[model samples]
Target: MTKKKSARQLRGQLMLQIAAGRFFRPGFPLNETEHRYTVYSNAWFIGDPPIALPVGEVVASTEMGHISSAMIAIVDRLEQQRPDGTDDFVIATGGTDLVDDLAYLMSFALNRTVSRNHDQTRRLVTGDGAPRGRSANDLFPELFEPRQTVQPGQWDDLRGFMKDLLSLSRDDFARVMRVIRNSVDATRRAPDDPTGAYTDLVAALESVSDDKLSTSVTWDRYDGSKRTIIDAALIDAGQEVADRVRAAVLEAERSGLKRRFISSTLARLSPDYYRDDAAGSIRPPRAPDLERMLGIAYDIRSRRSHVLEDLGEGVWLFTDGAETAYEPSFERVLTLAGLWRLIRHVVRRYVINAEKVAPEPWDYREALPGIVEMQLAPQYWIWQVGGLTAETATRRLNGFAEALIGWIAGQHSDGLPLDQVCQEIEGLVPTLPDGEARTSLIATHVLWHAWVDPTDHRPEASTFIDEYKAVLDAPSTSAFTVSLLSNHPMPTWSADDWVAMAQSRNDTRHTKSQAPLPAVVDALIQLFTADELELAGRHDEAVAFAANAVTELPGNEALVGWEARLVAGDHDPDFDVRTFLFGERKREVSEEPSGHEQSGEPSTEQNEAVTVEP
Candidate 1:
C-alpha cells in the first residue's frame, strides 16, 4: 500500500482531497518551510486546461488582465527597496492614497519631461518650510520661487518618480523574494502552554539562517539608544533567571485577528504598550530578554527604527561610538524577522490549544460584488498573468483580442473599412526595460491576426512577421522569451524543416495578442490592395492569389473565396482594391474555385498603391 500521501506529495491535488473530505493529512512535524510551501502552493495554484479564444482558438484568461498587470507592477516597485545599509532611495513627501497602482506609479516615477520647478510640484513655500497652500490637497497649490526656499534642495515629485519606475522590469522581485522565502521554513509544531514561550519567541526572532538578510541592519551610535534588535534577540541572562519570564501563557481564545487578541491581552499586563488609543503600537517590556526583543521589533515596525547601535556579533555597547547608519527598509525587514518569532511563540502558547479553526479561503469570494464595483484601468496585463510565463500571458491577451474582435464582428457593420475599427490596436509594445517578455506578445499579435483575417498575404507583411513561425515553433518558447535576454537574440531559423513547422503555427498560438479587431479588418484591406498589385498587369486572366492555398477550412470559406477571386481576377491589374472589396462585394463562398474567370495576362510591371501601416 502506498504510504499515506503527504501534502507535498499530492502537490495541488491535495485541494481535491480536502474538498472531498476523504483524505488523510500528511503526518505532522511539518516545518515552517513545508507549511509555507503547502500554503502558497494551494493559494496560488491554477490547475485547469488552457482556455480557448472566443473565436474557438486557445488563448487564456477572461476579462481580468488589467488587475494582474497592476499587481506585477507593484511587485516590481516593492522589489526596488535597497538591500544595503544606506536608507536613501526615492522617498516621497508622504501621501500614499494617490500612490497606488503599479503602472500609474511606474509611469509617474519615470516621467522626466515635466519641469520640477512648476507651481504644482515646487515644495518650499514663502516665509517657512511648508507647502505654499499648507498641504497638497488645497487648491492654488503654488510655492515660492525656488530661489526663496529656506533649505535649497530638491524634493521628489511623487508622481514623477512613479512614472519613471513604470518603464522598468521587476524580474529581481521574484529572485529576491525567493531568497527571503528560503529563510522562512515551517513545522506544524503542536500547541503548547506559555512555558518556554518567551524563549521560543527569542529563538524564532534570532533564527534568520542567512546573514544576507541582516546585512543592512545597523544602528546609529550617536543617537543615545539602547540595543539593536539583533542584540536583543541573542541576549542571554543565564538559566538561573528562568523565573524572570512570563509565569504562564495568557489563557485566552475566541478570536477575530490574533493581532487584536494578543494586543488586548498584552494591554492588561503592559498598559503602556496599548496606552490611550496607541493600541497595536510599540512599547518596551522590561521583564525578560525575549519580551525585550519583541518590543524592539514592535518599535522598528511602528517607529521605523532601531534606536541602539549593533555591536559586533549579537552584542550591544552603550558607548558613544560611530555615527548612526540606519536604513529604514532594513529595519522593516528586521521587524518582520522579529514578528515571525513572536508569531511562533503565540502559536505555541495560545493558538495551539484553542479550537483549531481552519482558514476558509473562499470567504473572500463573498466580497466579489463589492470587488467588481471598483473602476480599473484596462492597459496593464502584469498582475493578472504574473504567475504565467510570456507565452501563457500572451495567450491570455489573445483571448482578450478574440473577445474584442468577435464583439466588433458581431455588430456586422456593413462596408466599414477594417481600418475604421482598428483604432484600439495601433502600436506594438515598445522594448520594455529588460526581458524576453515582449517576444511572445508581438508574435501572438501577428498570429492572432493571421487567424482572424482571411486575406493577410504572408509575403508582403514580412517586415512585421519575419520568421514568426520559427519563433512560435521553437521548443523553448515561454514568457521569459518576452524578456530581453534570449528571445530577440534568437538566430534566424533558416532551415526548411523549421520554416515548415512554423508555417502553420498561427493555428496554435497559446494566447490572444491584444491586437484590435479593426487592425485585422484593415489588414484585409491592405491585402486586397496587395492582391491588386500582384495581379496588376494581368487583366485578361482568372484572379486567384490563394487558389493554391493548401488548407481550405470552412471557418473562413467566404473570405478565402473572395481573396482567391480577387487575386486571380481577369480584370485590369490596376483594379481598385477598395472598389473591388466594397462596391462589387460578393461574399458567396464556394468549396471549389468559381471555375476560373478570365483575366488580363500576368505581367512583370508593378504599380504603386497607397502606403498603409499594418
Candidate 2:
C-alpha cells in the first residue's frame, strides 16, 4: 500500500561520485613553492619541524613538560617581535589552523596560572576563599579603597580639583570617614544581599546632610505626573533622551527641595549635573536635588524602581523586579561610584556651614603665652597645662589647651594688636574709685571662680577673699588693675561698657527692671582690688597700677613719679602670697557657711538658681 523509501538513497551516488575521482580532489603532495613555504614557516615558528602527527596523538604521546616547553617557546617568539621589549600575541582566531588552536590553549594556560596564584594570595591575606563575610576591599583593597576627597594634583585641569578632598579640615575629614566605612560594609555583603547596605548607605548620606528633606515626597503630585515606566527605563538603561530625561530628573529634584534654593548655582559648578552654559560646567546640586538623585540611583539598583506602580498613594510597591538580594552588575557598581563621589562634595559643605568654631587655625598653646607676655600685667592665673604634642596632650593636661584656644578665638575678631588692646583695658582702671570694694571684687568675686587653681585647698582655695586690713588699716587707695581679673581683659571699657557688664551679669537671674546694678557700688568694688597690691607694702606694684590707669587726672603723673621714686628705694620683704591674696573674709565665709551648705559631693543642681545680687 505504501512505496518503501530507500534508506540509503543518496549513499550509493555519493560512493560512486567519490570513486570517480572528480567528486574529491586527488591528493597532490605539496608542490615546490608550497612545500618550501610550509617548511620555512614551521622552521621559523616551531623550530625543527617534527614528523606530522594527529593533534590528539601529539598531545597524548608528548609529556606535559615538553608541551609546556613548546608553549613557552611560542610565547618567546611573540615577545621578540616588539622593539620596545613588550610582549604581544596576535592569534589568527578565524582559522582552525594548528598554530591558532595552540595559541588559544597557551593563552588559556597562562591566564589560569595567574588566576590560581591570585587565589592563593587572597587566601593568605584574607584567610578565606568565599565572598561571604569578606569585603571587596578585603580581597582587593588596591581596587576598592573608598575615597572621599579628591587626591592632591589628581585633576588640576578640572574646576572640582580646586575643591578637592584634602582641603577638608580635621573635623570635616572625620565626618566623611563614616561614609567610607559604610561603603566598604555594603560591598562586603554584596554577594548575598546588597539591600541592607543599600539602606545603610542611604541612611549615612541623610545623617550627614541633617535629613531635613525626607518627608518631601508629594503623593498627589507623583501620582498625577505621567512619568511612565518606559521613561524611567530609558534612563536606567543609559539611553540618551537628554532633554526629556533631564527635565524629569530636575522636576523630581525641585519637588523635594525649596524652589528658591535651586538654580544655575549648582549648574555653574563642575557640570556633573545639567549644564546651562554652552560651555559645560558643573551645576551646584541642592541638598534635595542630591537626595533625589540618590533615590533614583537606589531605584536603578532595583530599590523601589519606577517599574513598580505607586497606585496614586505616592508609595512605590513591589510587583516583580524587587528583591532583597540584587545582581551587582558592573553597570550598577559604576552608577554607585559616581553617586558616592557627588555625595562627598555635598556633605562636606553641610558640615562647614553648621559648625561655629572659629575658622582661624590658632593653637591655644601659642596664644595663651602670647597673651600673658605681651598684653596683661601678670596677676591673672591661667592654669598651667602640659605641652601640646600628640604624646603628652592627652596624658598630662587633658583637653584644656584645645578648649581654651577655641574660646579665645570666638571672643574677638578685632584687628587691633594684642599689646595695644591690653594698654586700652588698663586705661579703664583709673576711672573706677579706689577702696575696699575693689579688693573684694577682685579677691572674692571676679578672680575667685575664673583664676584660682582647681587643685588648691587652702582658705584661698575654699574661699577667695584677701585681707588688706593687715597691711594698711584702710589699704592703699588706687584704682585697681581691671584687665587681669575681668572677662574683657584685653580691651578698653567705656563708662557704658562698665554699666553693660553689670547689666549682663544681672540679667542672668533677675528681670530687666532689676537687672542694672548700682553704679556707685560697682565703682567701690573696683577701688580696693588694686589697693591690695599697695597694701602689701609692694609700692612698686602699686605705682605700676596707678601709672597704667590714669592719663588725664591732674597731679596723677606727679603722684606716680613720687611713688615710683619711693618704691625704688624700698626693698620689700619676703611676701606671703596666701595671706596677701586671701583675707579674713575667706575664713569668715568658710566658718559661717549659713546660707549655703558646703559638701564634698555637689548636688546635681547645686547653686543653679541662686538670687542675682549685685
Candidate 3:
C-alpha cells in the first residue's frame, strides 16, 4: 500500500554554501589563504583548510537548513563583530550553491564534483580572496572606499566592540541588522538609482523611528477643545453625523508617520549641527535648516513612494563633486551624502543611547579632573552613572564623603586649583554605585567643596552664598544635609521634595546622628533648619531646634545670632545677616556640656516660646 522513499531522502543534510568578500586585508599570522578560519563559534569557515582549494581560490562554508538562514547568521555575526561604524567586513555575499549528501555522493562517483556545477561557486574560487579588481568594489565603491585593513594586534580591537553590540535585545538586534542591511542597500544602489538609495537610507532611519514616537498624545487638549466646540454646534445633527465627527477628531490626535520620523530625527540629531557652521556646502545645516531639510526629504520620500516622483539626478552629481546647481523644489537642498551623514549621526546616537553603556572605571578617572575644572564654578555637576541602584548609592555615601574630606584637606598649595586638588573626588563618586540619590549626593558634596575649600582661592563668601541660593532655587541637591541646610522655598518645589527633606531632617535630629558635614557647616545648616521651622509657623519647634543648635556649637557667632533673634522677636534683623551667617568665625569649643549629649534626643530647652514679631 505504501511506497518506500529512497535512502537519500531519509538521511538528507545540506552543506552550507557561502561566497562573501573579505572586508579587511590580512596582516595577522593567518595571512596565507590556505587556512580556513573558523568564526561564529565554528558555525562557518573562511577558506578551505582540510581540503585546500586550487591556487587563486578561497572557501567559507557551513552546514545549515537554508542558504538565507545561514547567510543571515553569518552577516549578523560579522555586523556584531565590527569594532566601529567605519569598518564593514563581509562586504557582499554572493549567490549560494546548496549541495546535499546524496548529490555529493553521486557527483563524486561521476566526476569528483560535489556542487551542481563547479562554476556556480567560482565567485568564492576567485584569485587572492580580496575584493580588489572585483565587481563588488566596482558596484559598491562607497563601502570599499573607507575599508580598513586589520593589522596584527588590531584584530582584538576589531572584536572589542562586539561585547557592546552583543548586549542588544532581540528587537534591538533585529532593528540594527535591518539598518545595516538598508544602509548597505543604499550604498550599493547609489550608483544606479539615487532615488532608491535616498529612500533606502531614510527607510533605515524610519525603521527605528517607528517605535520612537511618543505615545502621549501631544494635541490632546486641542483635540478635546475642538471636539467640544463642534459637538455643541452639532447637537441638533443626527447621531451618525456626530459619531463621524467624533471619530475624525479622535483620530487627529494620534501621532502619524511623518511626525514620528521628524520627532525621532530631531531628538537624536547631534547638537553640533545646531552650532554656527558653514552654509550651502558640505557643512551640516543649522537646527531650523536641518528640520526643514529632513521634512523636505521625508516629503520627497513620500512622493516617491505614492506618486513615483524621482529625486532629481542632480543630487547624485552634486554630491559626487559636481558644482553648485539649483533645483526649484528646494532652496537649500541636502545632498544624498549630507542626508546619509545626518542619518548615520542620528542612528549611531540612537544605538549608543540604547546601549546605555556603563561608565568604565577609567572613564571616570580620566573625565573627573576636566569636569571638576569646568564645573568648579558654582554649577551642579551630575555624574552620569548609568543604571546604578539607589540602595547601592546610599551604602556608598559615607565613604564618598570621607574621601572628599580627605582629598580637600590633603591639598598643599594655598588652594591649588580647587578642582585639580579635589579632582580625585569626582573619580570616587562614580566608583560608588550609581543612582539618582547617589548622583544628587555627589552634587551636594562637590558644591560644598566649591563653597568651603581650605584652599583660599575659592569663590568669595558673597559669590558662594549667591551661588548656593541659586542652586537651592533649582533644588537639584538631594543630599539630606544640604536640603535641610538650604531649607528655603524652591520656585518649582514639589510637596514630595519638601516631605522627604523634612522627614530626613527629623530622623537625623531625633537620633542625634552625627552630621556628614564639617562642624561649622553642620551648625550653619542647623540654624537654617530653625529658620525654616519659624517660617512655617512652627514657633515652638523653631526655638527648640535653634536651642539644640546652640548646644551643638556653643560659641559659634551664627548660632548665637540665631538665638538672639529668637529672644528679641527680631524676625527682621537689623544686623548684616550675611555677615552673621558667612563671616569668618573661629571654632570656639566649650568644655562645658550643653546638657543634651547625654540623651539621644534634641534638647527641648528653649530660651523663650517666642514667635516672630509680625
Candidate 4:
C-alpha cells in the first residue's frame, strides 16, 4: 500500500507541476503523435479524459508559436518518469489545458489548509503550494469576490475568525490592541514595507461587517460601561498564562533541555508563524490570549507609575483590577546608542544643507552650531557609555575638522571673501580645545589659505603669524607648528625697510632688557630671501654685505640671495635692471650675446666690477 503523503509533500508536488507547466510551456503546437500523449497525460492527472483528448488535438493542429520550448521539455520529462502500475492513466488522459486549471484548484486547497492550521499551513503555502491560475478563485469564490458578493454565511465565518483573533482576557485586550496597532503602524512606516499589499488586505478586511458578533462576547458586555469588562478579563487571564509559561520556559532553560514545550509549540505552528511574528497564532489558544493581554497590562502599569511619580502622589489603586504595573528593562547603553544614531542623521542633513548656502565666513560658523547641537553633544553620551573610546573619538573629531577645512577651501576657491573666511575660522577655533594636534592642523590650514590669497593683505595676517609664534614658543612641542614657521610668507616690505627693521629689533633686544625675540619676523625674512651657493662669479665686498644681512636677521634667505648674486656677478639675464631700480621696465633687450665667454669661462671683468647695492 502507498504511504500517505504529508501536507508538505502534496504542496511541493502541486507547486512543481504548476511552475513547470505555466512557466516552461511553449506556445507552439506539438506534432500529431506528441499531442496525443500530452493531452492523455494531462487529462488523467486532472480526472478528465474527454477534455484532454480535444486539447491534445488542439495542441497538434495549432501552431506552437507563443509557447516556450522549455515548458514542453519539462512536461515531456515528467510524462516519461511516470511510475509503472501507478494511477498515471488519470494524468495521461487529462487534457493539457485542464491540467493548468487543476493546478490552480490544488493551490486553493493548499490556501484553505493554511487558513485552518495557520502555523503548518502557512509554512507549506509560503514555501511551496500557492495559487497559480484564476480558476482557484472559482473554487473559493468567497475569498476573492468583490465587496458586494460576500454571502451572509461567509460574513459570519469571517466575523468568527476576527473574534477569535481579538478574544483575550480583560487585562490582555489593551496590550493586544497596542501590540497589533503598533506592529501594524511600524510596518506601515518601514521604508521597505509592501504598501500596496498591505492596503489591499486592509481594504478587503474592512468591507466585512462584525455585526453578527454577540454583544455579550465583548468585555463590557454591552452594558455601556466606560471601559469594556471583556478587555479587563482577557488581560488578567493572559497575565496568568504568561507567568506560567515564563516559569516553565525558564525552568526548561535552566535544565538545558533541548525539547522545551515552547519550542515544540512554535515548531508545530511553523511555516506560518515566524519567530518574529508578533501577531501570535491564528488559531486562538485555549486559554485567554495571555501573552497579548499581559503586554497591555504592562503598558497600563507603566503609564500609571509615570503619573504617580510625576504627581509626587501617594499610592493609587487601579479600580480596573490590573494586578501589576509593567516596567521595561531595555539596556541604557542600547538606548543611548540608538539616540546617537538618530542625532547623527539629523546633524548630517543640517550640515549638508548649511554648507551649500552659507554666505561668506559665516557659512562654516553657521554649520558649527547645528553640528554641536545635533551630533557632538549626543555623541558625548555615547562616548561616556564606552560605546566609543577616546581614540575613536579623536579620529572622528579629526575627520570632522578635515571636512570643514575642505569645505572652506572650496568656498575660498569660488571667490568667497578671504577676510570673512579667516574671521569665521578664528571664531570656531575656540570650540576645539587648545593644544590638540587637530587644533594646530586646522590653524595651519586657515593660515595657508590666507597666505595663498593674493588679495588678502589685511594686517590680520601678521596677527595670525603672532598667534602661531606663541603656539610654537610654548613648552609643548608640535611638528605642525615647526612646519608653519618654516613656511611663513614675506610681507610686501621693501629690501631696505626689512633690513632696517631687523637691525632695530636686534639692537633693542640686547639693550632694552631682552625684548621679545620677534621669531615670526625673522622667519618671514629668511624664507623669502634664502640664497643658493651654486651661482657663478664672486666679489668680496658683495659677499661681505650678504654676511652682514644674515647676521642682522638670522636665516634671511631673500636678502642673502640678493647679496650673493651681487657679489658673484651672476645677474639673471632676464632681470630688467630698470625694473629693480625704478619698479618698472625702462627698456627691452634685443638679441645679444650673454656676457660670458663661449668656452664656459667667466668674463675677464667679472672680478673687477662693483656690486650694485639696494
Candidate 5:
C-alpha cells in the first residue's frame, strides 16, 4: 500500500494549487463550488499553520505594530512634502493607529507577523471599543472641544463650554460640510422652502462660535443661510472670500513670487472658489483657463509678439514667475518669426527632395517618345500658339528646339545632369524668343532634330519621328516645314550649309514646273552633304557630292532612291515627298488632264501608259 502524505506536505500542495488556479483560471467564478472551497481552505491554512502560536504572542503583535507605524510614517512624510503647505497632518498622523490595528488583525489571522497598515486605519476609527492605546480625542484634536463642567448659575457658563470644531484644515472642514450637504440632498427639499432641510444645515452651522476653531463652522453657516435667505449681503460675502484667494494668486504671479505654491494652497482650501471682479475698483483681468492659456502662449510664440514689453521680458516669463532683465524687442520678434518661416521652407525642400520630384536623365529619355506623341501635335502646336504672330511662333519653335537639345545632352542613366542642362539652356535663351509660342516652337524643333539625327541616342527618337509624321500629314504650312526639316538627312549640317542651300535655290529661278521639283530636292541633298559628318575632321566631299547627285537626276526614281538611301544609311528618314510636291505644284497642274489620257484624243488606257527606262 502507498504511504499517506504528511499534513505539512498536503498543506503545501493545497497552497500551490490555490496559487496556480488564481493565476491561470482568470475567468473562473469566485462563487463556484471549487473556487469557494479553495478560498476557504487557503484561509483555514493561513489561520492554523502546522505550529500553534506561542503562549505570550507579544512579540508577534509588537512587531506588527512597529511595521505598521513605519509604513504610516513613510506615507506621512510624503504627504508633508506637498508644496501647497496645507495642513493634512491630521489625516496623515491619524493613519498610524489604523495601521497598527490592521497589523494586529493580520497577525491573528495568519498566525504569523504579517503587517497590514491599510486595514489598521479602518479598524481604529470604526471599531466598537474606545481605541486600544489612543482615543479619537488624541488623534483628531480639531474635531472635539474641551470638556468642562458648568457651575450652577452664572449664565450657565456658555462661553467656555461651547464646542468649536472649525480649526480643522480645509479637507476636514469640507468633509463635515459634505455630510450636512448629503443630509440635505437626501431630504430632497425644494428651493422655495425656507424652513426646509437646507435651513436645518444653517441652524447647525449657527451653533458654532466666531473663534479660530469656529471660522469654518461660521463660513459653513453663512453659505447654508444664503440658500434659504436669498440675502444679497451673504451672497456678496461668499463671492468676496472667493475673490480674495484668486487675488492672492494673481498678485503672486505679478510679483514673480512662488505662484504655483500660492495657487496650490488656494486650490486645496476651496477647489471651486476663485476671485471675480467687483464693482468700483479696477480688478485685474481674470486669468485664462489652462487650454486657452497654452493656446495664447503658442500664438504669441508663433507670431513672435512683443506685447509683453510693458510687463518686462517676454510673455513666457510670466508663466515661470520670473522677469528677464532685458525687454523683448520688435525687431527680435520679427527675426524669430522669419527664422521659423525659413526653417519650414528648408524642411519642405528636404522632404520634396526625398520624394524625388525630378526624375533621372535616363527616365526622361525613356519617356521622351511617349511625351512627344502626346504633346507635339499640329493642333496642339496651333493651340499653344493661338494668338501669337508668325515671328513669335518661330521664336518659340527655336527655344523649344534648344530645350530638347539641352535635355538630350544632360541625360544619363544615373541622373539627368539638370544643372548642366539648365546652364546650357540659359545660354541659349538670349538667342530665342519669349512667350508660350516660342516655347512650343523650340520644343517642336528639338523633337524634329531628335527624330532626324541617328546620333541622338535618346530612347524616344522613334516616337518623335512617328509623331512628327502625324503632325506633317495634318494640312498646314508650318507642319510641312516641320516634317521636311525633321525628315531631312542633314544631321551633320552647319549654319553655312543652310545659308548656301537657300542661296542655290534662289539662283535656280525654278518655277512651279521643270526645274522646280529638282531644285527643291537638290537643296535638301546639298544641305545633308554639307553637315559635319566626322568629328574634328575635314568634310567628306565624296559623301556630300554623292548625296547631291540624287537630287540632280530628277524623274530618275532608282538613282534618287539609291542616293537617298546611301546618305541616310539603313535608317528610313520620315518625309512626305507627295505632300511637298502637291503644295508647290498643285496650282500649276490643276487645269491639266491627268497622264491617264493621251493629249487631244480620248486614247485608250494602254496607249496612255508609258514605261520610263530605268
Candidate 6:
C-alpha cells in the first residue's frame, strides 16, 4: 500500500516514550532537577484532562529494557508519598506504547491496577509484555479496599513526609524500603511457604532492628594498675580497633540476641500502650507476653532454619486473624498477623527516625505550630532568661504545674470558694520567676478549673483582667503569653499600644544579643490590633489591618477567616479569635497523666498482642 512498507513501519517500532502516571489525588509537584522524572500534581497540571502525550507523573523516558525499572522506582517513591497508613494516593499510569507495558510491570509490582490505556495501538511482538515474565502472584488480586482517599489539603503533608523519606542515604533508604517490601511479601507468601515466610519476616526485623546493645565498657571494677596495663595494650594494638573488641565483648556479655531484639522492639512501641489502661484504645500485650511471643517467633524461625519446619496449610488463616488477639493454638504462638503488624511498625519507626534525615519535617515548628512551640518554648525561655539549655525547665515546669494543680484540688476538696482559690493563685504569682510567672498564673487558672470545676471554669472577667494587668505590663510579656492568659476578655491595650508593643518585640527579635521572638508573637500582635480596631468601631480599618496581618502570616486559617468576616461585615457577639498556635478549648478537659509521669512502662499482667493506635 505504500510501495511495500518496511517491517519496522508495519509493526510500530519501540520509541523512547516518556511514561507518566496520573495520581488520583494532589501532591506537590517535584521537578526533574534531582529526580529522574517529574511529578506534576501541582496546580499547573492538576485537574487538566490527560489529552497530551507527556502528562505529568513522569517515570522516565528510557529504552524498552530499562522502562520497567524506572516504573518500579517511581511506584516505590509514590508509595512513600502516602500521608499515613490509611490513605493511598492512586497513581494510575497509562500511555499508548511501551508506557502500557511499563505500567503493567508497576501494577504487577504493586499488585494493583495502575494503567488504563485499554486502546493500545502498539504491541510487544513476542508477547512478553513485562520486562520480567509476570508471576502467578501478580495475576491474583488481593482483598484491598482503600481505607480513605488522601485529601488535597494533605498533599503538602505528603510532600513533607516523602521529602524526608527520600532524603535518606541510598543504602539506608534502600534497606528500609527493602525490609518493608519483604515484610509485605512475607505475608503474601504464607500459602505456600508459611514457615519460610515467617522466617523471612523475622529475619526482616533482625536486619533493621537495632540491637540497642551498649558498647560502653565499665572499668570501675579494675584496679588502676590493671587499667593502665589494658590502656597500654590497647594503644599498642591500635587504640580504635582495640576499643571495638572491648565493646563487642561487653555488648555480648551484657545482652543476648533475643533480649536485644525484644528491647529494641519494645522501645519502638508507642508509649501510650504502657499506661494503666489503653485510654479507650486497643491494649497492647504486656512486656513479658510480647517477649515470650517474640521468643517463640525467633524459635520458629530457628526451627525453620535448623530442622526445616513447616507451618502447615492453615498458616494463611493464622496470618489473617485479628492482630489484637493471641492465637488459640497448641503452642500459643503469636498470630502471623500480629507479628506482621509489629514488623510493619518496626520498619516504619526505623525509616521515620533515620538519623541522617536531619531535623525531621514532622518535628518542624511550622508543621505543628502550637504543639511544637509548646515543646520548644521552655528552651526559648531557658536561653532568654537563665542562659541555660533545657536542663530542668521541663521538670521544673511540670513540678510547678503539678504542685499548683494538687494545691487547687486540695483547696477545692477542703470546700474553699473557687474565687478564693483564684485569689490564692494570684498571691503565689509574686513568688514565681519573671519569665515563667505569667505562664504559671495562666496554668493555675486553667488547671484549677479543669481539675476542680469544669462547669464554672472562668473567674469573673474583670477579676481575671485586673489580676493579669501587672504581668501584661512587663516588657518580656509576649502576645502568646497574653493570649493564653485571656480567652474572650479583650486585652486592655489600645491599637497604638498594640502597634508599639509589636514594634518593640520585632526590634528585640532582630537584635543579635536577644533570643528571637517566635513569629506567632508578631502574628498575634497584628491579630490583637485588629481586634482592638474592631472594638474601637473602626470597621474599615479593622478589615484592612486583618487583611495585612494575613499577608504577614500567610498560613494561619483563623487570620484569613477573621479577615473575610471583617470584609463581609459579619460580626458575631460570640466570635473568639482561634489560631493553630492558641485556641480556647471548646470541650471539657479530661484527666490524664502529666507529661512528666507519662513515661511509666506497661504492666506485665495484661499480655495480648494488640494494635497500638498511637
lDDT of each: 0.26, 0.29, 0.41, 0.28, 0.28, 0.43
- Give a tens-digit lDDT track for model 4, residues 1-614: 32543322232122222222322223422211231222111111111222222111112212222110111111321221222323222122123332332222222211111111223322222222423321212112212211212133433443332233223222222222233333223222211222222232222222221222111222222223423443454465677775565455444443331212112222223222223221322222222332232223233334444553221101111111111122243111111111112122222222222212211110011111111112221111211221222223233333323322323323211121234334444544545566444344344334344334335445665565556544533321122223322244324444444345444434554574422222332332332222212132223422543455456556645445655565567643232312222223222222111111123322223121222211
lDDT of 3 at 310: 90
lDDT of 1 by residue, 541-613 (tens): 2232233221322344444555555655533334343332233442322211111122432222221122111
TM-score of each: 0.19, 0.23, 0.31, 0.21, 0.15, 0.31
| Candidate 6 deviant stretches above 4 angstroms | 1-160, 213-255, 272-288, 312-320, 324-330, 357-614
Could you tell me how far off, in angstroms, the CA of residue 546 lies in candidate 6 after the best superposition?
97
| Model 3, global lDDT | 0.41
Estimate the TM-score for candidate 1. Answer: 0.19
Looking at candidate 2, what is the lDDT of residue 311?
16
Off by over 4 Å in 3: 1-161, 210-254, 272-281, 321-326, 355-614
Q: What does candidate 5 score on TM? A: 0.15
- Encode model 3's per-residue lDDT on 1-614: one tens digit a residue: 22433322221111111111122223311111111222211112222333221111213344431110111112211121233334433322221211222222211111111233333222222212543333222322222232212132322322332233334432353355456546644654565466777787777878778434533333333345565788788899999987776666545533667667777887876665444212333444556566556667788788888998996655555333211224567666666656655655565566667753321111011111111112121111112133234443332333333333323333211111223313333444445554444454454444445444335433443343443334344423244334433233323444444434444544565574333333444444445556666667667766765776676678876567758788567753233433443344412222111112222332222211221110
- Report the number of clashing residue pairs per model: 71, 24, 1, 53, 18, 0
What's the CA error at residue 342 for candidate 5, in Å? 26
Report how far off residue 582 is in candidate 2 (Å): 16
Better of 3 and 5 by lDDT: 3
The runs of at least 3 residues in candidate 4 whose Cα sits more than 4 Å from the true structure, single-residue gaps closed, are 1-283, 288-413, 416-418, 425-433, 437-445, 448-455, 469-614
Q: lDDT score, residue 236, model 4?
A: 51
Q: Give the candidate number with the greatest lDDT.
A: 6
Q: Which tens-of-lDDT digit does each residue in 166-210 have in candidate 5?
A: 222222222333333333231222112212322232222222211
